[model samples]
Target: MISSTAIAAPEIQHWQTKNGMDVYFVPAAELPMIDIRLTFAGGSAYDGDTPGLAKLTNAMMSQGADGMSADDISRSFEDVGAQFGQGSLRDMAFMSLRSLSAKEYLDPALDSFTKVLWKPDFPETDFKRLKKQTLIGLKAQLARPGSIATKAFYKAMYGDHPYAQPSSGTEESVTALSIPQLKKFYQKTFVAANGLIAMTGDIDKAKAKSLAERISSGLKKGEAAPKIPAVKRLEKSQRIVIPFPSKQAHVFIGSPGIERGHPDYFALYLANHPLGGAGLSSRLSKEVRDARGFVYSIYSYFSPMASAGPYIIGLQTRGSQVEEAVKVSIEEINKYLKSGPTDKELNESKKNITGGFPLRIASNSDIVQYLAVIGFYDMPLDYLDTFTSKIEAIDKPTLLDAYKRHVKPENFITVIVGGEQG
Candidate 1:
């Protein structure tokens, strides 16, 4: 029952610079525009006791660099109608730019990107201002019930691991971080050897290669990244109930799931779609929202990362119904683990997953992202092309086996926020 939909993507060009910089490009001549993305291996995962190091480094890159004031930098980009932005996840930091194809503007935009990457000054004045703003944001998030619940969940699951550190550092941690610590972090991490550039838009092979070289010319190829130790596995189930004054009770139930490189990713991914990946049609939503009406919305997902990621099921409901909703959800999980999906459900899930896969790589920009990911994770060249076929081929028994091996409810962690009674 899987759709034989053919998924096509623009061919990706991959290469590496002499300085160990990986490069990926996808050409689209029609749009007089290009988007460039650079990613480095160290992110929040690299933050030592001085949490927020990676994020702070990324934020300060644009604040001032190469003797340019933050305002001057902003005005330079605004004059050309271009944008430069930065982001970080647990594993990598990303800096990207989008600009008009005109060389007069594009060259300067690229120059600004280079300046941030290679010559950021990390001005103490700007650092103080950004730190204050970051702390305020952190305090605001701590006031929310969902934030408290998630923080508690990570603490329970990851304990003192680097994974326990929130992407946005705690208020106390941010307030304690100084400009000197940020400088050392920048030197220790962000290096050419750990970085790559991904570009998409109007450019030929020669021009693209030259553009990459010009931007990365001054980068110092640094040492290999320090190895990140593997995440420790939890041996037993843990539960925490928190009471708060609120209209609804928020619940989260989860356990460690597959990593990005796990061989079972394809099977588990396909299996998850029918269970909760689909919106209204997914079993969790259908049972919890439509049939029983105990909750307004319910969702479940596994975020595959460098290490085992949290497999989570979350819901919000009337305070009095929290225990009932939790009971029903556990029952559903037990059933799914033991019996797996029916043939009809499996087929529909495959069809939806396969049919929708093409949208994931619909354009040059999309191809660039995929390329960057594949490069970062060292995935095979055929990953995008073979994705649909792989999903279509997953049978019921295989997925069931993976689920049984991975989803052990007894080892899961449950956190409840704003529920007076559990």
Candidate 2:
């Protein structure tokens, strides 16, 4: 068990701007740097008719804004010695900045960064180039067995749900994407009301507050996005095999897992740790890889999103050995399910997880990332402080029961890419 004094969560200060923008802050003056991340609603989940519109729109943000071209936008940050970043996912679109705390640099860095969120131009030239690049990426991804397997897995698991498509979208959908569509999606999603701000390192409350408000005010005022439609649970097990030219096969087995903050989340987390998430210490690695020599690597994880995300067990092996690898993997799952982790496994995992707690929040960027998740999901402020204790409290029966309820083979969606040629 972690002593209370062994770990302490940084003090988190949270408040909302008048316009409904959220701010989560932790002041860390030890470093001369500050990391700021801004997240908003409607990631790929809101792709609606177009599969990759949300991602494309996110990319277009840093290209140009307010008569500033991509080169100019990038150069501005470069000149100030600050780094700019942006990314999109199934649940949110975000922009991030890392800069020195000096007022001279922080002011202009924040200025340019703030402007890109609201004043994007989505220039025609960059749009064509970016779309062409996106299309090229799609072609490259389709050529790989691993990518094909993942794409098929999501499509099979979700089946026309908003989460069905990859964040990058398909080639056909991306080709047809237009600038007007991006503008509309941007206006609807990137509003002040939908935003959350997370800040860490080298700043006082006044500066954080002012920066949050300035960032919020730059965006158009609009309502928060509606809850994404629920994912439809699969009624039965299904397998999809797409034979590719590769000598190795990639296999993905999973079902819808828990959402963020599920009541039994910690139990499942510990359960998966020994089952597959603990690297060499995992059952999959020890039995399937070490003892049987069936797979190159095998691991499982629950990607808990705003909705129930995937609980995936992924592995790769020689095409001819695909059946054996999968059979062993499932056999291990059933055995583990029937009998939970041994007392030894549970205690070791707890130590392995709790031991690393300090390192997880050791840096400003790390905390900033956690802050983004906590703020976006409306999680408890003490979430970081309490994470290890929660893990410690979970026992074997609880972990096993949670796994049984959550991972049902009846609803498994398995996709295998590449196999022995028929």
Candidate 3:
């Protein structure tokens, strides 16, 4: 049952700039601060022939812009207590700014942010320094077993697909990245037509519009990026094991699941709570950790991305227990597919999800984040408002059907790294 007083979802105001950048906005008079997130089409998948160019480009942009040194830009924001952040992922690259609503802070912060975003200088001295840092970071990651497993897992799942590459480019790929290549990538990817902005806090629609317009005008009014191809499901199960010296083996199992707008998204989401997403109470945790005690911890989830992302069950187990852990996880999943969640489990999951829904949009910053996802994915504005109702509407049969339709236990592809499997 839902709470007596339902949590009110924030009102979202959306519009298109003159140059075509989509903007999502919400006003909160209580906070004297604002958060602005700008998302672009420049993700790791757009790296083209160079694997890490998109991420490198994003990092370099933050270091300097419009002839200003990184220190100049940072110090300007610091003087006003503004915060800046930027990163790249598989499907999108983003930068965010937080500042006081007072014009004293807002104007200067926005100025630095907009320039860094659109007119990135990618200063040669800093570029070489940052590239060195990236290469060093990549080497450190390679020395870890978990990183090895994650890369191998994607490669095994996606084969030669663009999505196969991790967001952090491989060392060889990063070394090959050049200033010219990144500049060309920036021109096509960070365009008004492929951009989205999400903002929340003390800004009015008029002010939001003006800010959106100023930033959008800087981007070239290029075309939207092409759609990513759908992922093909694995026909049969395949397990790839890599030997490492660690005593614990990292095992990741499962197959291609749903994409962002899948018909069964809500149902699949609710069902996963019992299967894996609900922490210690999850089925994987219960069967693999509590009942048998073969694993350090076990969990699972469906990553719904632009393409059909993975439905993964991840666990780390003692070297000798790797086989047992994988066997039990598969067994639990097949059982779930056959019978779905029990009536009791379904009810509990609904109550738990709906109860915790309010926290998702509790703050201006949280609303800005949800706004970003909603805008980037072209979701309905009423998404947060209707989220709880949607989860509560699912029944046992519906939940079971959605899980069955998306998960393929029989065709699971498992990746095991570290230790020798017994």
Best by lDDT: 2
Tell me how candidate 3 scores on lDDT.
0.88
Q: Tell me how candidate 2 scores on lDDT.
A: 0.91
Per-residue CA lDDT of model 1 for 239-347, tens digit only, reads: 9988877878888898888777688999989878888788889998888878998887888888877778788888998888888888888889898998888888998
The per-model lDDT (C-alpha) reads: 0.83, 0.91, 0.88
Clashes of 3: 0
TM-score of 2: 0.98
Tell me the deviation in Å of residue 3 in model 2.
4.8
In model 2, what are the clashing residue pairs, if there are any?
A: none
The residue pairs that clash in candidate 3, if any, are none
TM per prediction: 0.95, 0.98, 0.97
Q: Give the candidates in order of TM-score, highest first.
A: 2, 3, 1
- Give the alpha carbon lDDT tens digit for every residue of 148-194 in model 3: 99998998899888889977898889988889998888888899888
Return whichever of 1 and 3 wins on lDDT.
Answer: 3
Cα displacement (Å) at residue 357, model 1: 1.6
Off by over 4 Å in 2: 1-5
